[model samples]
Target: MQEPIQNRKIIHVDMDAFYASVEQMDNPELRGKPVAVGGGENRGVVSAASYEARKFGVRSAISGYLAKKNCPDLIFVRPRFERYREISAKIHKIFYDYTDLVEPLSLDEAYLDVTVNKKGNPSATLIAQEIRKRIFDEVGLTASAGISMNKFVAKVASDFNKPNGQKTVNPDEIIDFLEVLPIRKFYGVGKVTTDKMYHLGIFTGKDLKEKSLEFLVKHFGKSGAFYYNVVRGIHNSAVKSERIAKSVGAEHTFDENLTSEVFMMERLESIAATLERRLKKHKIAGKTVTLKIKYSDFTVQTRSKTLIYFIADKSLILDTAKELLYQEKMKDSVRLLGLSLGNLNTEVKKTIVVQLKFDF
Candidate 1:
């Protein structure tokens, strides 16, 4: 039997418009103005946009041309990935300082298991407040935090407040919160699932919980099990830490398409350097190097090389990337390039491997 979820304490922290916030923090001119990070031309996409720009319906991944059409006053600028990475590192350090059981969903968001934290803190709410304050004071950025008894609820609570805010949902309030929340707010419920739920009259968590697990499974496949459990506030997933990274990669979309090998090599060197830094930071090495290329026409392809031993050196990474890049014949000018290191080392446990089994 498992313990009830009323005892757990989890927190989800999400940085508000991460890239755009960083831009605003670095340049006072961008503050309180409509700003976006990406290309200004028709061909580019918005990587991140300020809340001011979002009001005009600008969004990340939307084409720069479309963004301009939505908000003519939107200011577009290229992404500063190096700076973002630096800020991410600082925020990550803060999370670790609270609890080692921090699972990063991205550079800007993370789920933390604070049931038993390092600071000897009794209340998860206080810890969240401290984290939010530290991020603003130390990193010059604002973040929203959510505190709950489980990961699912914590994530949802975090978004209840907008930029530079924190929200806590105590165990007693969980039921009421879930009852009123739309079904679409469930973590794994994307467009397709939400549509399916709508067809089934499952518009809210209460509606979802009314259905049988068998009935949900019959219609929704494997994810139906997740829906059944989540609606009832029964999630057993722990904050996992020892997940082996399958690959380490760095990519950049060029401001202008480059057909010259010399320019491509220069970009590759930078990517390799970034990858090497990440690998070292994680104390990881890889034996395989993969290069990804995107053409101006939007077609993409990848080439990879495998080595005998794990390597994390900058020179080795760049060499492999260069070799992989030239190995493929160019079909068009390249618009984006990426490099990745993979095939990490895994620990072997003799006792686990030697487990005895008896057939009945």
Candidate 2:
């Protein structure tokens, strides 16, 4: 039998509208105004939206056109990922100063296991407050923090307060805190699952807790067990401090559908250059290259090629992606093109040889 992990302290820290907040922080004129970060409005998607813009129903992954339609006064800024990464490094350094058990979810979010920390602090809430303050002082950005006994509750609590705030769900308050939480508020429950839950009359953590394991498994398959434990605040997933990156990729969405092989290849070359930059920055290489193509009609296809040796060269990545692209029988004009390098060298190295079909 596995040992139960009890009395653990976890803190989830998430930057508030990281990109948009950075923009406002750097530009005095943009403060307290609606702003969004993305590419061209004609053919781009919103990467992040400010709290002001969010009031007008603007959100990330929505088209820039739709964002502007929703909030006509919204200001759009292009993403500066390199600058964001620089700040992320600073924040991560602060996290390491406290504890080595930090698991980064993205550039803006991370989980820290601080039950026994470098500072010898006993109160996780105080540590969270100090970390948030340091991030604001050093990075000129606000961060929200959640303090709980596990990753699940900590992550959810971090979102309880917006932009610059913190929330703590202590051991004694865990059950009451979760019982009234709407099913949609659960961290892993997306729109499809939320709709499915509604149909099953599962609207809150209490409703979820009432279902037997067998009933939940029958409805949700493998992930059912995860839901069962999470509802009762029994998440035991550890914060992995040294998580390996799975892949390096870059994508571009064109203003118009690309049909000519020459033009499409140009886009692929640029994407390959971006991917190469990312891989080199991280000092990692992969044996497999995947070509992602999204057609004009929204149909998507991924074709991949695996090499004998791990490669990080831009030319090699581009050429391999080109070969994979040309081999596929495209049904429509390509609207987006992306390249990814996976099957990293650090893990059990398998070539995963993909069969090349000239006409399929």
Predicted model with the maximum lDDT: 2
lDDT string, candidate 2, 1-360, tens digits: 233345788899999999998889889899999999996366788999999999999999878888999999999999999988988999999999998888899999999988878897788899999999999888789999999888999999999997699999987788889889999999999999999999999999999999988989999998898898888888877788777778888998888999887899999999999999988888899999999999876677999998999999999998898899789577889989999999987663332211111110
Task: State the lDDT of candidate 1 residue by residue for 218-330, as single tens digits.
Answer: 99899888878776677756666554578889998888899988899999989888988998998989899999998887788999999999999999988888888779578
For all candidates in order, the CA lDDT equals: 0.85, 0.88
In the predicted model 1, the residue pairs found to clash are none
RMSD for each of the candidates: 7.6, 8.8
- Model 2 / residue 110 / CA error / Å: 1.4
